[model samples]
Target chain A: MNLLRTAREMLEGTSYTLGIAGRTALALPQLWRRRRETTEQCYAASVKLIHVIVLVGAFAGMILSLQTGLALADFGQEGSIGSIVAAAMVREMGPFITAVILAAAVGSALAAELGTMKVSDEITALEVMSIDPVPFLVLPRVVALTIACPLLAIVANVVGIYGGSIVAESLLRVDPLAYRETVYDVLARPAELFPFPKDIYAGLFKATVYGFLIAVIGCSHGLRASNGALGVGEAARTAVRNSIILVLVMNFILTRVMYT
Target chain B: MSTAASDAGAAVRFESVEKQLGGKQILRGLSFEVPRGTSFVIMGPSGSGKSVTLKHIVGILAPDAGRVLVFGREPGQLSRSELASLRSRIGLLFQDGALINWMNLEDNVALPLREVQRLPEREVRPRVAEALERVHLADAAQKMPSEISGGMRKRAALARAIVSRPELLLYDEPDAGLDPATGGSINRLIRRVQRELGATGVIVTHSRSCALTVGDRIGIFEQGRMASEGTAEEMATSSDPRVRIYLGIDGEATTERSDSRGAEHGTGATGR
Candidate 1:
């Protein structure tokens, strides 16, 4: 009986998520209609995270480069650290790390905001005023996140590659000239393994999909919130947890589809 | 002292409506009507489906059984655009003000004008100022709702409700959690707005003072059903035990009171 109940809940949750996606798609035109609102939301979503993104990206790149360089040293392949770090950052860590940060910060904020509105009757007020809350509230947040994530991921990629270079020069003692040459060779060579630019494109695609999914999860949990303050808190907690798990899962699937 | 039916002149009418929420029956065979250009008050204890009934009129919730007609059109039967059009003609003041916390008082009141009416900023500004002035919150227009007092918040909500000059107004406990003086003033403002706009008004309250003050006709709800309905005078002198108990009137004492005195003083101090 418990298993059946759990299965029913999972089905309901999936159906609800799909329904929100369809509604969000239909409400896309609202982004154009409410351009100022969309822009403001985009600014709010992205502006405060610049410092955090830079720090996380740089640290991730340094740590990955150091670990990979140490492992390769035993095999006398330490000089190849730049190529490996750049490829991994471009293909996976950059987008994944950025997504995790945004899921915790912006996604949870969206859920809390909409949940409070639900509890306060503000969403009902919009309905009473004949303004659909999906178009008025959800559309702007989704569009803003979609536009912000790719841009943030680009920043993460640059910082991560720079950090990797620094670590390679300082800790690995790989010749700076040799590291630069390998990075350029990896990115510039069209026939290299994993190829030039494909991994970068894959990273950007993952970022965009992650952004869209995070917004959907946050908004859906918010709109479904009931009970009041406790309900709002639960919605925010659920949004963050679900978004992180989905991002990791999606990262794997996207990697398989892109590389294989 | 009977269930009012929908008439050609009625602004809102509920016919044998029933609603269930969370596996609990909230409204059971409920029925009432508010005539155009008059105030109809539904007085009931808490959890008696008063708010649910108001939601049905706005199409926020649909009835599980029976019909809700607003402006002679069945709300549940309307298309999306039709419902939007119908809702634009109505204004609702929620119990807790329900102001958007992100926006300050002026912007909150101006939202309907800018969004629903699609008015320009220049026009919306003056209209917002006018609404604030009417509610005596003009000086506090720039302040957030949290910065204001409870009475001010309620007044701000009232300002938003009347800003668009809606033809129908629904107020959910306009005087809830208010002191008697403040509640009285809010009731008076509601009456004044209704008269000035010549709009149909429906108010749900548990306060007999509020019902008698604003209601041209009054309906009492008990246990998700309309127990009885009548004018202020008729309700005060009603012989129904439920009505007597709900009104807090002793049957013998009410009988000894002159009909004129009951009618004159039935609404308490706010009536004048």
Candidate 2:
């Protein structure tokens, strides 16, 4: 019952603050005095994106190579390996892997930092000063997350494809030229890779939606945290749990609409 | 800052106000007027709804019943812009100071002006400097809240409170956690500001010296009501047990004196 009540309150708070954030976005020019290219913000976001892309991309690729090799060997067509790996990474694994990485890394950080600020009365101080914190704090994060995540997925796709290529050549004794040719041929097909413009669009849309969800949960939980150390930990934990769940749920819905 | 002190009007007024939290009543039918150009202290022990009353003035908490009028307009009913205007006109000093630890003292104090007004750097810089000077914290303007002493942070928070030169001021335990000397200085500064700017104040404090120095007419909170009110002089002289106890006077000594005086006068006027 207590958990249910807390969830209800968190939802209410998120919606209320999001409405305020919407209004504040309209008044951005004044609040953001130094809108002259936020290089530091973009740099920080890029570092987070790169870290996830590299780790998830390499791991997914190695698993795909090993498993696909064994499975395809039974069918007597292990030569289809490169095409299989390339297609899977671009269409399915890339977006899903990227979202999960963000949910754990960047999303959790947002919750922890904003949560600490909230518990420390920073949000209240901003309100007292007539500075609406929703826009000042949440908007930049949402924008950064949305723009960075999709780009990171593209990078993950390429890196994962390379990882599979390495295994095919080094471990599986497949000719590098043949593997490259198969990957290129499979990826070149518009239908297999793109499917529909809606597929790519849906992935991007999901990224943005995930961004919105993460920021909302992080900020709301942070702002309403209890007054000390334990409060900060709770906010971070709640943000990560809620954001990861919401991301997977959203991805499932988007996938159904795009593929099924 | 100088121009804001020029306007003269009733700073804040509460008419039959009521507040409830979690289905429990915090304030019940509170009605009062705080005239401009003086300080009025709300005296009460803990859990007396003092902070709730202050929040209503800033629209942080809305009264469930009755009207809250600030500068003659209902605070709850005001449009966002209007509410913003009213808030900018009134300065609130929270009990915890509510300083933004991320920002240095200058930025924290400059936050309101930067948000509410589109003033140039030249204009805002002087005001920030002047505000810091008023709180005797001009030296610590560039220091973060973490780097400053507790007393200095409180002073910095006070500087933030007054940066906009508000016509009305609210202090939520301004002397809380300060040493006797620092607390006394805070009281004197509050009194001095009340005189110089002629800003009406609602000070919520536990300090006896704070109430006596800052409040022209003090209200003693009790039994879900303002049980009694009078000038400091009248309250100091009152034989009421609640008043006597709060004032730290000998309860038995006052009771005996009142009894003897009542017997000598052959009346019950002083007996109660």
Candidate 3:
């Protein structure tokens, strides 16, 4: 019984969250009008998060490079470690870390802030003023995250790939020049539909999707909060948990669709 | 059976409106009318659905049955734009101020004008300044909500509510958490706004001072319905035992458990 109830609530929450996004799309014209607020949110989403992205990205690349190099070294193919690390970071880890950091850090804060506003009657106050919260509050946040996610993912890819190359050269005894040449060769592989390689474009696309999902989930949870402080706390927690789940699910689905 | 509209005619009319929230009936066949250009006070014990009624007037919450009419049109029947138009003509002061914490006092007050009125920036500033001056918060214009005192926050919210010069003003427990002096200042500001704007005011409050000082007609609510209504004089001299008991004028309920917190909208508060 409890499981069924929880499932029903999850479905309802997802439906409402998407409903908010749909409404936000209808209010897109207002985005240009409210560009100042959107720009501020973009700065907030990116600048506050750059440090975490760099730290996570660097560690992710270093680990992948070290593991791949040690295994390949047994076969006397350690020179190929740099290429594998580049492929993994560009196709997966870079976007993954970006999405995780955004969901855990920024999404939670958005949810908590909005949840506090809802419980305290500030949201109702906006409605009373004939101001739709969708246009005024949700749109800027969604736009900012959607735009920030891809750009930040690119930064992660660069830093992570560089970290991996360093690990390959120093830890695995692969020649530094050879490692760099192989990494470049992998990225230089012919592309079909985009300027960048399929892996690079696909990962950025995934990050963008994750960013949009995080903002919608966060805003929806916040708007639904009631009962006060405990409710606000729950909203923030749910935003992070649900965003990460959705990101992983989307990542798998996108990987299967694009690569296959 | 009782009516609460001022003698001038109904600006807002609730005809046997029934609303259920969280599986509990919060407003049970409730009915009342509020006339234009007068201060009407809805005084009730906590959880008596006073604030809910205020929300209904602005179309924030719709009744489950019956009708809620503002300006002879049902708020529930209006289109989104129409409802917004109606809401634009009204201003609401929330119980805890509800000022957006991110914005400074000036921006907060300027919201109605900037967002609703869509006025130019030049037009918004002077009106905001004027509203702040009225509430005696002119010096705190640049301060964020977190930087201000609770009383100042309430005053700033009031300024925001009136900056648009709305035709109808609603107050929900306008002095909920304030010192006596601050509450008194708020009460005085509320009266001044009503007198100066000639706007219809529906104030939902438990403060005896608020009801008596500002109300032209005072209605007492009991369990989602109006128990009685009259001038402050009539409320004080009321003959109905229920009215006297509720007003605590007759000292009847002091004998009971003393803490009869009525049902909350959700926390199992139901109409008797």
Model 2, residue pairs in steric clash: none
lDDT of each: 0.84, 0.73, 0.85
lDDT for residue B9 in candidate 2, whole number 0-100 = 45
**Model 1 segments beyond 4 Å from truth?**
A189-196, B1-8, B237-241, B249-272
What TM-score does structure 1 among the candidates reach?
0.91
lDDT of 3 by residue, A24-82 (tens): 99999898888999999999999888988988898899999999889998999998887
lDDT of 2 by residue, B1-272 (tens): 22244334466777778888888888888877788877888887777788888888888778899888787777787777777877888888877678877679998898888767767888999999999887777777888988876667767787888888888889998888877656666666667666667778899988776777677787877744687788866776787887766655433322332222112122211111
- lDDT per residue for candidate 2 within A76-142, as digits (tens), equals 7778788888877876787778877776777777777777777766776677556777666766666
Native contacts conserved, per model = 0.93, 0.48, 0.90
Write down the worst ten-residue block by lDDT for model 2 chain B. Answer: B263-272
Leading candidate by DockQ: 3
Which scores greater on lDDT, model 2 or model 3?
3
Tens digit of per-residue lDDT, candidate 1, span B1-272: 01235335589988899999999999999988788998888887789899998989899899999888898888788889988888888999999999999889998999899889999998999999998876677888999998887777888998898899898999999988888767766776677678778999999887766766677787889888999999866887788887776666644333322232223223333311
